[model samples]
Target: MSELTCFKAYDIRGKLGTELDTSIAYRIGCAYAQVINPTKVVVGEDVRATSNEIKNAFAQGLMDMGVDVLDIGLCGTEEIYFATKFLGISGGAMITASHNPIDYNGLKLVREDSKPVSNDTGLLDIKLSAEKNDFTFADVKGTMSVVDTTKEYIEHLIGYVAIDTLKPMRIVVNGGNGAAAPTLDRLEVAFKQKNIPIEFIKMNHEPDSTFPNGIPNPLLHEQQAVTGDQVKAHKADLGIAWDGDFDRCFLWDSDGRFIEGYYIVGLLAEAFLLKNPGASIIHDPRLLWNTIDIVEQNGGKAIQSQTGHAYIKEIMRKEDAVYGGEMSAHHYFKDFAYCDSGMIPWLLVVDLLSRRSTDLQTLVSKRMTAYPSPGEINRKVADADVAIVAVRAKFEADSIAIDTTDGVSLSFEQWRFNLRKSNTEPVVRLNLETRGDAVLMQAKTDEILAILDAHA
Candidate 1:
């Protein structure tokens, strides 16, 4: 048995064969069974090549511990959450590297009610158990059964938004050859049955583990271009794309420009507030001015949170927030067990556009101009902590205020910047936004980059 090194701060992930394999995955399954100790555990995998092997090994390990396994085959990360909650099963694990490279595979585990399990959560217990490699087998092992959640997931998603009186709209979907194609294709079928006014244009809808086009991460400019071109080519109202497991999604305007996730946070906050007025909403601290402005101006309470899914979800459940959003394209809902979904946000966005006779550009265009943000930029460095400390020291001389909810976030009257260490890699991620001043945003970005570069 090899020592485990892929147990990350957030989830278990590593390069295939070297850092992870069927054997290690099997041990993790057993460890999960031990930690969660649920009577039944729901399992799911993405469209990756090694997902099956890992899923099978995990299932075997679960059953060996006499824990019943309900396998929902070939679904996105949120689908597993739905299965676990919809079926009242124990915790579940989704086999995906989530926007990681094709050569990598990992797991996202959650407790019952779709609560995330991070390193500080039950993952530590799982790590210890996997290292020990001791799983006591019962006299009779639990059985494994396959369940299809496609239809149920679709119904649940559509139920969140109005589909009956949806207006006629042309929508372009670019799955980026990840898991979103199958779900979107099925959703298209459902939209057709409802007589909803929607024109569907699907591109790169096939699920290819190799990701021949590129990694499905919409954060990259090149990746966004492919989907943007489709939106312009089809002359569609909006375009949407998903990451590898389809957990978090990205959007493009009718004019083929990538809508920053910060504005989408405001858009969805406004959407939910219309229904449940005065409901609390959680906003990540990284990008906050516009989200706070829109949420408060619209009679919704905005609660600032740290930068990760674990922190966001925990805050949501505690505050009973109606909605939560991260500028990284993660949207969490109170209805969906306070878990993040790449699927629900688009559905709600579609509903918003349909209900109001407005195109995607019109809905978010004003916010973009009002809060022009320098999109997130990352810099590789030998010691990310050193770079962060150096940046903080420079800013401390005349800094207005500083907060380290997730990383180092400095706030000033005109501009603000969040310089944080990446949880998964040896790089520091930077996000800077100004109150409608594009020039100031660029200047702050350049200053931060210089600091990071000097440290590098």
Candidate 2:
């Protein structure tokens, strides 16, 4: 058996046909069943053109191992997580490449109760078993069944916000030709059924596997313009966009100004703390000061964890945190079995907007001005470690505090920045925040880039 390159640190991903194909996906399914040895498993797929073929092949492999498969067709990654926990299933897998390009695909796996399977957990074992490609068949093959959890999932989402309290606000939603369109449609119908007067100005609101408007990654500046334009053209109250699998959602204010994910973290922390004061909120180390201030000001505890969904979820469960957020737009909720959701964050934000009777700009602008951040900037270098070490060495003498939690974080009296290597890509990411000094932020960002450039 040949080695498979699709296995990654947290999940399985690779270019289609070359690095991954139906055969490899089948082997992975068989290997997962062999390693976990579960009686039943759930499966889901995104809107990619090849997803159905890959998912069907994987399910066949599981069935050959006597593992009954509950096929939840055409859904996001979080849906699989929800079904795994809600249905009392032993395991689940979602076939998606997330924000990756059109030519790529992968699988995100979880065990019982929707617990993630990272490299340190069960992914490596699954990879090794798949590489061996030798498995014993069960006495009897298991059966396959189809199930739809759309209504239940929508109901669960509506539970987050009071229907009557939602004002008749016009909001723009850009699905970007991904899986979010279907889910958004379902939510819209549910709101109407409940007599909610919210109006949805839909844009690119269809599941086109071809990605006619390009991929749904709103993180890129180019991909953000369409949503911003729509928001402005419709003169909507707010704007929201999602990735291909709809696991992460981005926001725009009433003026069509993009809100950095860092501020959204602070906003969400405040929202949760309003209801449950003294609760714990988990955040990543990349961008800290804003989140720390918001969490502390609300009489809540702020805990910093390493980046990545697996780490955040684990820390949230341990600390019993009400919420956890990453600057990269991933948000986790304790009520959602410690798993991250794209749907829940937007729902909670809309609720906050309605309850406050304030526009999105007013809700977050103060926090943004108090703690200005350059969001996350990325630089490609020959060696990320060398660049990180150089930055730490140069700043250690003047830094008030230094932390190596996930990367190198140096804090001074007024400002701080974190330099870390991207886990899934070959680049170094930098995040800097200052105490109401945009000039100082830009100057320091330039200095750090010079150091990184020297290494490059």
Candidate 3:
């Protein structure tokens, strides 16, 4: 069997025409049918230009294998997860490359009950089968049906926040000209039907496959001003933006200042603890002092896992976590089949505003001061392993404790940092945080960068 470069550690993603095309997509669909062997599978596509053709070819492959296809047209990734469980389907696949460049595309696959299909969980098998391309068509071809799960998804999201607890507030929403607008529009209608007094001022709300306003990748922090300026201009209480598929969201405070995803993890952890005391909360190893403090003070438990969706979701299932937040802006919920949702986080955050009657900055500023972090910084090196080893050697002598759970995390009396290599690149990521010391955090961050530079 030949190797497929499109198959990645978590999902199938690659450049559009070269690494992934209609032919490869067909093979992948047939392979998925062969490996998963599901009778009925749910399929959906984002707003990418190539998504429709690729999804159709994929559906044909499933049909040839006698697996019925239920198509949910034009949706975000979480919709696939929701439909997979909501419709009682055997499996589901979403055609999206969430936050990837304009010319890239890929698929996020999940099996029954919305469990992820990653490297160890049947993705590699699917990749190998696709490479072989030896599957046969069944005697009776499967049929295709278009389904609507919007109402069900909206109702489920509404279940997370109480309407009476909501206060009159204005919010700025930037759809990133991707797939988030449709869902947001529907949610506005639902909120109106329920008489919720929240006003939504939308930016880049229209869906455009060309991505005229650039891709909706709020995590990159490049377009933070686009949403932040609007929030301040409109005098809105909060600002929210989503990536292409609306799976991960980024936040901004009232003064239009960007709030790092690291702090959002802590904020969300505290929110979950306030409602469900002593609930297990899952967090990534990077930039987690704030999260730990919040969980502990609020009478909850904090569990750290590797920094990836598959890793976090597996731990969510194992621990039955009430909520899980990553520094990369991914938030997972037990109520949503342990899947991450971009929409749920904002709803809960706004609900927090209503309950506390305070602004976003006021809520996060104290935690931001108590445990200052510069967020994750990436450094490209000739050899990532050498760089990591070099840094560990320099810090281990003075470190009070060290952790290699996912990476080398060295803790001092006042400051701590986690240095880990990237899965898809020859780069090392540094996440450093200090206990109520922003100046020391910056100094340590600069020191680590200098060491990484020397090693490079």
Candidate 4:
């Protein structure tokens, strides 16, 4: 009866046993196949027990619609993007929950060149078609075949970063027990064969669906400790970790300090601008001060985009942007078909350091101090609207410009803050930054917290 059960603001995510059974997945695939009318579709899955089954069911649906399926079994989300472009497929889908718990699963759909499919695009139509239960199977059913896209993917990734040029550096990598190990293993061997003096301190490299070491989400403080400790203990050049599906990645400096994604955006922007001057860079509106300053200073254009992969990719496509990054650890590249890659950022940074005579901390230290931000703070309240209104109203009376494009962003001469309500959760996310002043940023952050408390 409920036709709007599968669609979400960004992707198709639902519980496993109840809303997201194999039948629903297959029907959704059939609907997608009919809508897109693509000849070839690339499919990939994460490290979950149900992932393969769901993927196969969806493949069946596609095949029923006379669409050939190119199944890249057990690969990361980025690999799906690579396969789509490398094989010139019509589109691709990745069955992954990302950082979600094992009980949940979802599908991230994309068009050719890995164009994201959101509600504004064709996701809503696909959902409606699936719910109607009137799929028109093709007279000639499509066929399916599996292919390993990792070799070409790794080769292309290596081209992005010169592993052979890497210096004798000790690095720490925590796979978090997800899908990162395979790629890392191949990369490690490549680095070794090239005699790029480097050492790998691997933790939780084994992929286990049960997540014995815990769910492979590096965003949580609990999971970040293992990589941070390894960085400190080994005095490694840096630490890298990935989420459940290895789509988004997190990093730590040599000193066991977790570098926020905001600074990394600046770092990568700076690095990319060095080679491609006068290029355009895309960034989410959540954190703008640092990215804007860095991009502009490096002779690159900084474009603000709405949150989510779909919006970012769409904007990048139109603008032909060279790079786009989000503070949430999503990095998109032009060569990668405007798709986010969890493997590219660290490699770029590492290559930059290897070619130069500087350490990771030294490279980012000045920028970190110049534009310090109160790393995204989340507060759970009963009503996110009430909290956002209270915060916005309190700040708007001070002769500041306010915009609600995606959220309430108040800009003052000295400082600015954005308070947005999360669509995926019942919470208000706040990010504030000052003009080279940590004390002022902290003061504004505390003031907003007081308003939140009073309203709560």
Candidate 5:
């Protein structure tokens, strides 16, 4: 048995040909089937060049294990989640690296009802089983079928907003040459069918596995300028972009100013809370004041969970939270089987914009002013834990409140910051926010960086 290093905390991802290949994917499928023993499993693939081959191999392995396969070809990760719950399948897997470099490919798995299969849940065992390369074949192989889930998924997304209530608006949508293009096409047709007036200025709207523009990661500052520039060039009311698998969405205002994901969480929370007052909202601990403020002000309960989709979804299910959002732009909803969707967040925001009769900038500018955050900053360090501990020791004395819910979050009277190590990389992430004071935020950010730099 060969070693397998592709499995990670939340999903399986690795460089193609080296750490992951068709054979490895097949082994993973077999291991998943044997471990979970699902009767039927749904499979989907992104627009990556190797995705089809990998998907087919994985399905073959599942079928050999006597597990029926439902292949929903050329879709996003959220679509697989939607199909898994909507079709009542036992399990599902999405073949995607999700904004990783073109040389990479991977899988995101889920159990019944779109419940995530993270390391803590069952991914580690599956990894070990695959490494063992031990499989007992069943006498009868299960059947395979193809199903197109686009229409139903689009309809489900449209339900989040009222078509008639949306005012005529021009928007720029940069699909980043990933899985979002096809879905955007379906959305256009749906809008036309409902007679909703929306002009979509498409940029990088085609799915090209080569990624001519770059990987579709909007979190990178370099990848964001294109969307912002397109929004300005088209004079669109707002700009929206998605990562490779379209599970996360980023936004830019009318003036081509990129809005941080932290603020979007607050905006979306306010939107959901208005619809379902007193509902619970789950938020990540990295950046809290803004989300807590918005949720509480809107008569909603704000619950803090660790920073990850699995954690947020579990907390959402436990609390029956109406919505859960991470500052990284992943938004989960109760109606979507407690899964995250890239399409729904923008639609809800558009509805809010139309109802308010204001541009995206106007809607979020005051909130940004009230709670200024420098966004999340990452530093590559030799030892992330050492750096985190040093920063904690430096700030522990002055902090009015300290919480280790996810990492080291220390709160002061006028400002606060969270310093935590990355789950998948050798880096420390720092997030700072202050009370309506950009200067203070900057100063505190610099102070924290100096501490980090000294240790680095």
Candidate 6:
């Protein structure tokens, strides 16, 4: 028995072979069964080359412990979240690297009701058990069943929008050869059957385990141009891209400009508030000015939680929030068991555009001007905590206010910024936005960069 490095801050993720392998996966399965003690659990795998092999090992480990496994093969992380709650299972797990490099892979686990088992909640206990690697087979081993929930999942997604109100529009979706291609195909069929006037122009839409077109991350500056160019080339109203597991989706406007997720958070917060007035909307501490402003203006309450899916979901359930959003493009819905979904965000955006009869750029241009942010800027530092402390010391004296929710957020008269260390990586991230001054936002961003560069 030995410690496992695959266990991370919120999930199981590590480089293959050295840090993680089939044996570690099996140990994790055993640990999950021992800790959760569920009669039945849902398991899923993404399109990564080794995902299925690792998933099988994990499932067998569970079966050995007398825990039945429902295997949803070749699916995104959100599918595991959905199946856990939808099937009323005891737990759920997914095998995916999720925008990590091709050589890397990992697992995401949740207990009953699709609640995330993160570090503080239950991951540490699970890690300790897995490291023990002491297990005895049950008198009667459990069974494994192959399941497909694509159609049902699609139905649930479509229910978010009224088919009758959909206007004719063209959308460019760059799947990046990940897990979303099949779901996109199914959604196309559903829309056609319902006579919805929407056309999808897909780019790199097939599930290529090799990821020939790169890892499909729209957040990368270099990758952003790929989707934007396609949007312009196809003259599509919107461009959408997803990571390896499709848990987060990024968007670009008709003018081929990538809209930061911060603005989309505001847009979705307003969208949900339009339907459910006086609802509480959950947002992360990083880049929340836009979200809070929008939520307050729409008769909604914007509550800030520490960043990360587990914390966001916990606060969402605590406050009974209708929606939660992170500037990193993760959007959660109260209706979806308080789980985040990449598919849902784009759906709601499309529906909002159709009903409002406005173009994508026009819909968000005002917010973009009102609060201009450069999205998240991550810098590798020798020590994350030291870097944050140094930056805080340099700016705190001049700051009007300070917040330490997930990271250090300092407020000024016209602009504010958040500096935090990443939970999963050895990097310090910075996010800043201005009330209405884009130039000040840029200048301050540069100033912060200089400080970080010197201190970090």
Best by lDDT: 5
Q: Put down candidate 1 lDDT per residue, 1-456, tens digits, no spaces.
A: 556998986789999999999999999988998888878889988989999999999889999999999898888999998888888878888999988888999999988888889877888889989989988776889999998877888998989778676878787888888888888888888988987777879888899877888878888899888889989988888898889888898999889999889899999999999999999999998889999999989999999998889999998989999999999899999888888899999889988887787878887878888888877899998899999998888886677898888787888888888888876678999988888999998888898899899877
Tens digits of per-residue lDDT for model 6, 325-418:
9989999999999999999999999999988989889989999898888888988887888888888888999999899987899999899999
lDDT for model 1: 0.88
> Which digits, one per residue and each the tens of the lDDT, describe model 3 over residues 1-456?
768899998999999888999999999999999999999999999999999998999989999999999999999999999999999889999998877998989999999999999988999999999999999889999999999999999999998787998998898999998899999999999999999998999999998999998988886666998899999999998899999999999999999999999888888888888889999999998888889988999999999998899999999999999999999899999999999999999999988888898989998998898998887899999899999999998889999989888889999999999999988889999999999998998988998899899867
Could you give candidate 5's per-residue lDDT for residues 184-261 as a string of tens digits?
A: 999999899999898899999999989999999998888788789888888899999999999999999989999999
Q: Which stretches of candidate 3 lie over 4 Å from their true place?
A: none
lDDT of all predictions: 0.88, 0.91, 0.92, 0.87, 0.93, 0.91
- Alpha-carbon deviation at 452 in model 6, angstroms: 1.4
> How would you encode candidate 4's per-residue C-alpha lDDT over 343-403 as one tens digit per residue?
9998888888877868878977888788879799988877899989888777799836777
Better of 1 and 5 by TM-score: 5
Model 1 spans with C-alpha error above 4 angstroms: none
User: How do the predictions measure up, each by TM-score?
Assistant: 0.97, 0.98, 0.98, 0.97, 0.99, 0.98
TM-score of 5: 0.99
The candidate with the higher TM-score, 4 or 6, is 6
Residue pair clashes in candidate 6? none
- Steric clash pairs (candidate 1): none
Better of 2 and 4 by TM-score: 2
Per-candidate count of clashing residue pairs (backbone under 3 Å): 0, 0, 0, 0, 0, 0
TM-score, prediction 1: 0.97
* lDDT winner between candidates 2 and 4: 2
